[model samples]
Target: MEVETENKYLEPLFQDGSLYQNELKCDISEKISDILTTITVFGSVSIETSQPAIIYKSKKKIQAQILSAIPHHPKSIDTISISLRSKLPFPAISQSSFRGFTVSPSGFIVLSDTSQRLGIMNSCGTYDFIKKGLNSYNDITFVDDITVAASTINAIEIINLDSKLTERVISFHGICYGIRYYNGKLLCSVISKGIQMIQLSNGQITDLVKQREPENWSYLAIHDDKVYQTTSNYFVRCYTMKGEMLWEHILQQSKGVARGITVDNNGIVYIAKYNGNSIALLSPDGQRCRHLQISDTKKPWGLHFNAITNSMTVGCVNGTIELYDISYSH
Candidate 1:
């Protein structure tokens, strides 16, 4: 389901001494608010407030509260597809190198090419490249608006976007292939160790799942509380946080190797079919599958979907990057 909020202004309803003046105002901007939300399976809700809640920015710490709440239903999706916007002029890397990219909530794109360069592009199409003291970056993800975490050969480096410098590094025992940030922690895919969860506050690592044998080039994406992972045997699997297999689907041999995976707001899964030269979108139930037609000739390697803005960014193995506007009918 989709909900759109229009741009408007909120003003004070009365003088400072009014009875409702002391009421808590919620200004938090994250998708997950501080107020606890409880919803049943495949459900949506809308909360209406008596007064407009103003959202403002301030350097000083601000306090707010929510004294009251409200609830909804789900819809059926008929079709899902995308349209090309424009090709992003990212510098080309080797065709055989690892390519990974991610989209921020505010519409910026962060990409990792080979082990030599990292590029950050704004909504205006201009970009900056960072290369000094760079390591072999296999994958990249946003920690927040101003920070990002990059997976290296055997470590994860926390880099500040403003300063473009490495702030901290968390070492690991095995090869780190894919990395993602959720809540306040980082979920990473390690070669033979499977998926590992790392707490950003404290350097604590927990094994969420373990692989039976060593593998190469593992990638994953998270939605709601479920984790989606791609396998080397031409399959995509869904698992719980505790490592329980929920469902698994194998793509046709014509799609080539499944490299990267991401899920949209509606729980629809997307995978980058490397040599097949296309991006595949699967239904939430893992029963229906469809391939997105790409006008480009380069093979698609990395995939990222921004649920808030309904946009997608695709990175190819030959260092080509493209953006698309996504739409779905229910």
Candidate 2:
């Protein structure tokens, strides 16, 4: 299930106020217009390991939502292995899974948020590139000009966007969760499997560090030879590149959750805490910056820092993206 849209003038529509959610399709240049989404879950959003939210910077605040539903009708696949449960066998009904977002270096942004609809968007408007028979890809990274990685549960795929195909780059035990490339190697986020580091030159995989104390995987970021990892509790742990736990910082005194993380050229870390409606900027030495704060009483999901302009971009769960200056004094 894929849907694509192509418009020659999405940018001007957003600029002229002719396309902010009402205009068929347009770029989200402001925080207030990322994506007007609706969420419906058959199960708990917290129970499952999901990447339902990701923050990125383009002309707009684009997003992807994960949905789960019971199949109305069952269909047989090419292969099926059944075992007895209690009174009968269980059937496998196919559903959908999504991966990380792809911010194109080529200035083309592709939105695969909902299955059956994949959007090729730019500042002007959008170009739809939806088709059937594509695998559910999770976690995307542009490795170089041609190579890209799409992570999923069973395999880590190196895909050629030019060819539009993927093959397993490596295999893992549990879900091959989130991944990011920093300083040449691929750092993978795992559920109960800790952080796995794979050298892209060769497919050699090794555990950089194992997650201790908690049974959940939230997010991971690498900067200044430190691996900043978070738990479901919004408790952040800064560990050495060797996986040594260095220090911990709690964004808020409460039991809230923090997901999105971005750092600026000044080594200031910004946190996006959902439902808390706050974005925090922390010094490289772990001190909170007094002036760099954005609070709206509604949880924010994504953030991006632009050093070129000395500003930060924020995305709210309530359908808005806002940019604020960190240079202002309190």
Candidate 3:
């Protein structure tokens, strides 16, 4: 776990000048017994209105959740969302220049910023403070119910949500971009060096997943026992959860950079990127299946997917939260 060299993350991958042929056994089975769902974010405008739209998918049914943040009447310091057309309203926190939002494995939402204070909110609108130490809020990822982390200039802050404790903070050679939590494991994006595995349970750090051939990832997502990421040049690369390269897919000549990613129960990956006025759906292995574009092209910054309703939660830089439909009938 102690990454000793600049190329440390790759050490365990090659033990003795030979490929670590330690064929990592895995449950890469695609037999998902759960319901099928998908979600994509996009911007769209009607002849009468120009607003961001949210896309969703679940059980072959699609629904939309509007992301427009309207005033909650009392004018409190807490940020909350009220659907102008929604019957069920909830309180949530919002911050400025913020691009990170994460849903804990326990269903709590953490919206954070290094420029501002970090906020934790639940579906009911209750907000709490986790910690404060980042110079700039790059991204937020949940490690578990008790632990959530954020990336700043040169380090990652691990916070304990239950006790409001910052357990540990660590830095590396490059800036951190995005992170994801799965089964208590973490995958962190190191701007120029690529992804690093920060083992939460064991307290270890593996730096250069694969030496010399890293995609220099910027965003991270884990599913189907593989790690999916958006690397430099808008390419999508898939690797084993522990940093093994299973496959790589690229969108050559695509309009913009791949920014964020989400996956559905059916094993499809959804992407939000720079040149996107819509959401791009890719195969589990990184192939572009199709793109669902919004009528408007407002820049989407943060996105979360709820597979149960196929609802895609989107946060745009233009100050809006919208939902979209991404379900396809089989």
In order of lDDT, best first, we have: 1, 3, 2
- Mark the regions of model 1 whose C-alpha exceeds 4 Å error after superposition: 1-78, 92-94
Task: Report the number of backbone clashes for model 2.
Answer: 22
Model 3 TM-score, 2 decimals: 0.63
Candidate 1 collision pairs: none
Candidate 2, overall lDDT?
Answer: 0.52
For model 2, residues 1-330, the per-residue Cα lDDT tens digits are 122132334444444544333223333334444345532322222222322233223333333222234333321211111121111101111122222344444444333332423334343434445322244544555576656665565567776656655544577675654566766688777777778888877778889877643333355656677777656556766678788887777777452467656666545566766656566555666644322234442455445455566555454444333545555322
What's the CA RMSD for each of the models?
Answer: 15.6, 27.4, 25.4
Worst lDDT run of 10 residues, candidate 3, spans 80-89
Candidate 2 lDDT score at position 219: 58
Q: Residue 304 of candidate 1: its Cα lDDT?
A: 88
Q: After superposition, how far is residue 215 of candidate 1 from its true place, in Å?
A: 2.4
TM-score comparison, 1 vs 3, better candidate: 1
Cα lDDT listed for each candidate: 0.75, 0.52, 0.60
At residue 109, what lDDT does model 2 achieve? 38
Instruction: Give the winner by lDDT.
Output: 1
Q: Tens digit of lDDT per residue, candidate 3, span 133-183?
A: 637667788776667787777777887777777788876666777788767
Better lDDT candidate (1, 2)? 1
lDDT of 3: 0.60
